[model samples]
Target: MNTPHIAASRRTGFFSRSGVRRLAVALAAVPVALLAAGCSSAKSSSDQSATDVINKLGAVPIPSAPQTQLTPSADESHPQLVAVGSAVAVTLPSGTGTITALGPTEDLPTPLPATMPTQVAGTITLRVATKTGTVKVTTTDLSSRDDHGNDIALTPVGVAQAAATAGGTADFVVRGTFSSGAAQITLREDGHVVAVWDFNIELD
Candidate 1:
């Protein structure tokens, strides 16, 4: 009964079972390894992207011209101060706070007219501490001007309007393209200049 043929058959059967089990384990581990690798790569890429964004936003350049401070009149209750790469604070009749002009750090892909030279993107944050009641702010309250005394239109990309509490902040994102020979950017609120940032923007 223990012939060579029978012994060979038993050995073959044992090897087949063990090989199948090994193959199954190997197949099961593949997806898990790939998943881990994918997760690690995704996290690294996301972290790098975030770091780039932060660096771009944080390195706001200073303007060429000196910062200007405008009070309008001695009788005026609110005073505005303009500084490059810094937050400008003003106290309104109803509230007091700061306005930070985040200079254009990135060029947007928005379509421009033939007359437009270059389009840039920026953000403006307004923080007001109400003395008595809430202060209402709207998109129309903001404006931009170039060095040539020509007004550069600010197209609102996004806006975050918080409840103007005694002390709260609101933010706005604006996009605009300038003409050739643009030198400075002036920001105005309700027809009065609040902040000015100078730039040596050269357009061909």
Candidate 2:
């Protein structure tokens, strides 16, 4: 029972079983490590692709806008003269009106001087007579333009009435200041120019 041959055989069989267990564990771990490495590589590639797309979008450009032009009407060709103490007659849809006076003044009537002027002051007075039904007049119906085709600012100074009935007369006054250049005053009704007055000045 205690023979050397029998003990040598038992030791060899135990060592062989231990070696087989170790080898099986190592073989199973190889697939798990490879799967983890594959997942890491795929995640890195996806992140780099996303970054490339973002960079491409950032490299694009933009655009801008355009401009336009303004054309004058036919009535702008002819203009009336401005003479001291004289009147210019203008025809309207309902009747006619006389631009009775236009001159430079030091003191404007009450409510006519909306703002204190930094330069000389100018005033325009008109008497309108209606032939048919009543005619409506408003401050917006009047405008003035400078020689450079720029609109001269105007403020309503006074008015006798908003409307003039048939056979009735109404008075209106507007005030502004010139900028050392010629100016043209205009009246518009139904989007058409009814009258235009021209004033030329040369200041010494």
Candidate achieving the largest lDDT: 2
Which candidate has the top score in TM-score?
A: 2
lDDT of each: 0.49, 0.55
Evaluate residue 18 in candidate 1 and report its C-alpha lDDT on the 0 to 100 scale.
49
lDDT of 2 at 41: 50
- TM-score for each predicted model, relative to the true structure: 0.43, 0.45
Summed backbone clashes in each candidate are 0, 0
What lDDT score is found at residue 169 in candidate 1?
57
Candidate 2 per-residue lDDT, tens place, 1-204, comes to 766564322223324664445445554554444446556756476555544654565322211121121212222233344443345454555554443445544343455566644445666665555555665556787788778887777786765335677777776777777656677777667666656657664442
For candidate 1, lDDT tens digit of each residue in 44-100? 765555446545663222222222434232113343444435555544444545555
Candidate 1 TM-score, true structure as reference: 0.43
- Model 2 C-alpha lDDT versus the unseen true structure: 0.55
